[model samples]
Target: MTSSPAVTAPAERVRPLELFFDLVFVFTITQVAGVLTAAPTVDGLGRTVALLAIIWWMYGGYAWLTNALDLARPGPRLLLLTGMAAYFVMSLAVPRFFDEGPFGLILGLAYLAVVLVHTAGFIGTSGHRGISRLGPLNIVSALIVVAAGIVPPQARTWVLLGAVALEALSPVIAGIGGFAIGAGHFVERHGLALIILLGESIIAVGTVASELGDVLRVVVGSVLALVVSAGVWWVYFEREERDSERLLDAMPPQRRGRAALLSFGYAYLAMITGVTMAAVGMKKAVTYFTTPLHDFELWLLPLGLALYLAGLAAFHRALAPVWEWTRLVAAVAVLLCVPAGLLAGGWLMLLVAGLVLAGVVVVSRTPGLNET
Candidate 1:
């Protein structure tokens, strides 16, 4: 009889089941955004980011996990099923992600279950650097998330932030000695995850449109949000995703994991967070189209775009430094416009943010930005 081939499947394609598991995070991102949608305050926004970091860390594990696991086998396939179940249950608690309520406890427990599953599954696995050296650190970071739920809300934010930092930095701090990448699978997985998050923006449009009735103003606002999302898509997939994929495929095996760590693990975290934030802003803008802007509510779209751009730029810096400065400037410009957005009202501010991002996309096509 054959031994279990749960780990070290290098040539296998990403299976349909893996794609099916990804469905859960679509709702996961939405739930995080819904939390901010409800509050749209400084505190609410901070909590949303904290919650997103935790959620992203959990989702990210599978991306790296599957890159090493031989999911064609029963053991790994069942592991994924269990992880997805936990992911869905935890997503249900995302709205209360940082609230010091029973839901927080539930979210923590679910998240811990996910971490435990991955950590335990990877135990005794051979020749997987991400799982081998960095896996234990993932467990530690997840424990921080579990601890965060029990703390007061204020401290919960900091604890979650720590959890994100620890997990994101694990590659650098812990080093992925045995970590290797099946580049094709790794790239496809992360890219699909980005698409899923971008789809959240589209989902936001529909979700907002339905709530807003069929008014012309709402229609226009909805279109603008889609435009913003499309422009974001172009900025990323136009060159960045392709380049990163090429780079990962070209890298030597021993080094591939760290590069994946920097480019996909940490960088994609920023991108996913930014995309989710953009969805939150877009949803709120749907409401703001008819209503007037108040205080920080106006900041959502710009802030969202800024984070999204910043994430892109950070990845560019890590992989290809030349594009970094330009991306940074574009991100900062959006951020600088927040005060104007605060006063400009929702629809108008969204229009401004959308236009500015469109311009950034144009600039991204310049000769130098093609360095990949």
Candidate 2:
């Protein structure tokens, strides 16, 4: 009888250097928040989403890369430091990415460098069959960003969007056969990323609250935003995380890669989108406390909450391979409540959304609440 090779899980603890490396990603998130603060229009919104999509893909690549390799080695360690430098430069350039100027080229090239380091570096070392295919595919995708610099602004936007779309689909397209996942590290990394995003949401609410003339609105809105943020923390952290990690740990080695790709990579994209949009809405709500919400503002918070719930549901489905329709119903309730929510000021809107979120957490505790 022939024996199959053993599958090894990487260390469960996330390293200090990994946390330090994520500091740059936090900076990137703040930069994204600032971009919206700078230009709060439909077009600006598009730009922010495009930039964030690119940044998220780049950041996600690093998580996968580190999970695959022993980064304590001098070669991998140095390579990661080099990538951090690139990320820092990318952050500096993000504010001007849409200006159709030098920053476009700088941002494109910097991202290209990150893509190269993660893909080419790994492929050269591991000879993994999936990565062998993924390497060339991502390099082609990265080159699209470089091409963004050469084109007109409209064309640049389209090019970068194309690149983001391509990279987002790459894992599914590649199938990642025979790839491995460090379930502990993989789960921890994504969980930490979610925490950072929620922190950013809190920062957004506070930033808006600081400038308000009304002490009441500031106090109330700040509290309400925290409630919503807390609700997000509860829903994801309460039981889902532990359960999800267990599922990931139980997955066969060959299959875990696909679940990580779909669950963390694609589904979490929606979760991040929800938080980012909610932050934007919170900022606007604070700015216009006494004023009526624009149709967009009225819809934004509900939309964000819905996306967050729906995304988490998808994430859970990926983890357990079972659809959670009750959660989907909760997502719809968030939207249904929006019209009534808009009748009140921004603070009330947040309060209403927070209630919806709290309800999700409460309802999920009951039997069949998470079932289809």
Measured by lDDT, the strongest candidate is: 2
Candidate 1, TM-score vs. the true structure?
0.89
* Candidate 1 lDDT by residue in tens digits, 40-154: 8988888887887777776766776676677768988899899999999999988776665788778888898898887766654554444657678888887888888788876
Best TM-score goes to which candidate? 2
Tell me the spans in candidate 1 whose CA falls farther than 4 Å from its real position: 1-7, 11-13, 99-101, 124-132, 290-292, 336-344, 369-372
Error of 1 at 319 (Å): 1.9
Q: Candidate 2 versus the native: TM-score? A: 0.92
- Tens digit of per-residue lDDT, candidate 2, span 190-214: 8887888788789778877886657
Worst 10 residues of 1 by lDDT: 4-13
lDDT of predicted model 2: 0.77
Determine the backbone clash count of candidate 1: 3
Model 1, residue 318: distance off in Å is 1.7
